[model samples]
Target: MPQKFALKQYLPNSSRLVYGCMGLGGNWQRLPLTDGDIKQAHAVVETALEAGMTLFDHADIYTHGNAEETFSHLFKQNPALRSKMVLQTKCSIRFADEQHVGRYDQSKSYILKAVDASLKRLGTEYIDILLLHRPDALMEPEEVALAFEQLLKSGKVRHFGVSNMHSGQIKLLSRALEVPLIVNQLELSLLKHDWVDAGTTFNDDQSKTNRVLGDTIEHCRLENIQLQAWGSMANGLYTGAKIDSNRFNDKQNAALLATKELVTNLANLYGVGKEAIVLAWLLRHPAKIQPVIGTVNLDRIKACAQALTLELTREQWYQLYVTARGQALP
Candidate 1:
């Protein structure tokens, strides 16, 4: 275990669970937003706020930029809601259309322009935190620092961070910036255990070689960068359409089934939703990771909020981990 980074010190009353706004804007490549979609967004946003989810996660490319567009409707309805929430959005992931190849763009101009677009769509004067959506292969750290400095000076963005970035990349960018990087968003869940597995198997041959998270979890702790996990529910392996997908191999399928069985038993024992157990698994980690759940269903949102109240013991936590991993620790 390492020193903890408390988010409240930075956000001043942020929630443990972040509501990922990816699902709010309806479908991708579809045009002409419908009234039902707007209504659903309102309902989901209201539900998350009621559940104490102050941090809303968004990306400029989410639903082709309509997630933020749809969420702006809430502020349009009640402007006061703006003061109650901490808004965070990401930029730099450009989709591949006929005109340009799909790639990352951390260039100063792109970052600056993207933030302005996000602010306009979100209908907010300032974004509480702005994150680079993913690591740009050609990123100029100094250029990125310039963008951060300009945004900070203009009072458009308060803090800066990165998503899907390793410690080396974060370090490079941090060196060029005056402000501290506060968050590192990554894909972590009961199903995605590589981050923990790397540490446990650090010096062993049985350790996975290619799946290393580059000491990211520990690095984040040492640097006091809060980790925010996306895809934290494992793409609904336990709660949604498990049988229909061909994404898993035989071994992975077996692990998934065993993990589901164990989660179900524990879920019943604790008298909480299955989602809570999934989220609780991450919350129990010393990192105090904030899981960004992408479901727009009100009931499911409330179920995830239950994780804040439930705590798993050390033995129970390891039991779930071993069950999900399909093997005992080496």
Candidate 2:
């Protein structure tokens, strides 16, 4: 049988590269968005769209919810653009304020309210996919399931998923959910390879013996849930001049310089931008990891799309992995 929430099921022509809209909205300081902010967002959206990237990833708490508000300007300018893309936004993150500390809320009331607020901000009646921003410590599975059921029945959200979740939590939530959870967005990149290290160094007693995310990856694969990777570019760790500074500690900077050298060599061999090479490594996985890139610069955004077409060989992939990990396989 086919998987319940395959990428193509919702996004047939979706780019393997998902665009993160966190940079669209201005800073989170509550200042009014300037005309330049809108213009930058417009250029980013236009660049991504032209590069065939249609799946946009958003969170209600991004830039204090102004990110979605900023993106709405695009649709307002070209209303038809709304139908041309697959829009996915997240809820459940309650920002910190005077009244309450920052926390996660999966309660029925909060979930429902967050969805309505996100819809209003996006200026859309329905969301393509609605993801719970994070796992709530006090989450009542039945209450969350009820909210999802109502949202689906009311045509407010089409799909459901979670971020930063593991297998045990997903199973606990799935028991009460009539709809299958489809996506797990994780913080995965060359620099942050905990997800891969645990598997590669299994049974070894090095610094990377936690193996926490191993079961989560296996469960997602078995359940046919798509894995979306955030921070896919690693905050430009390998982007020129960024790693050449003297501020970092000796050990840390030394490791970075080594990895940057390896990345540079691979970039030359592959004849593509370093960002594409980095993203392509994630794409080369059998799990079909979809990387969400957060770059707003038009040139970098377009450069990242190149990962969709590039293919890294098995040896090259492992080489990049070993270099990034700064150690050899056991």
TM-scores of all candidate predictions against the true structure: 0.96, 0.94
lDDT of 1 at 169: 91
For each candidate in the order shown, give its overall lDDT on alpha carbons.
Answer: 0.88, 0.85
Candidate 1 wrong stretches, greater than 4 Å: 1-5
Per-residue accuracy of model 1 over 1-330 as CA lDDT, tens digit each: 222346766887678899999997879975766788789988998999999888999999988988999868889998998998999999999988899999999999999999999999999999999999999999999999999999999999999889999999999999999999999999998888888888877777758563458678889988989899999988778765455448877877888888888888888988988899999999999998999999987888998988887899999899888888876788
* Residue 71's lDDT in candidate 2: 69
- Which whole-number lDDT from 0 to 100 does residue 294 have in model 2? 96
lDDT of 2 by residue, 1-330 (tens): 221235776567566789999987889898777777778878888899998788999999888888888767777888998888889999988888999999999999999999999998888888988998888999999999999999999999988999999999999999999999889999988888888887777888763555677688879988988899999998889766366466677766766778788878877877777888889888888888889999988888877877766788999889888877767888
Worst 10 residues of 2 by lDDT: 1-10
**In candidate 2, how many Å is residue 41 off?**
1.4
Q: After superposing candidate 2, which stretches have Cα over 4 Å from the reference?
A: 1-5, 244-249
**lDDT for 201 (candidate 2):** 79
**Candidate 1 TM-score over all chains jointly:** 0.96
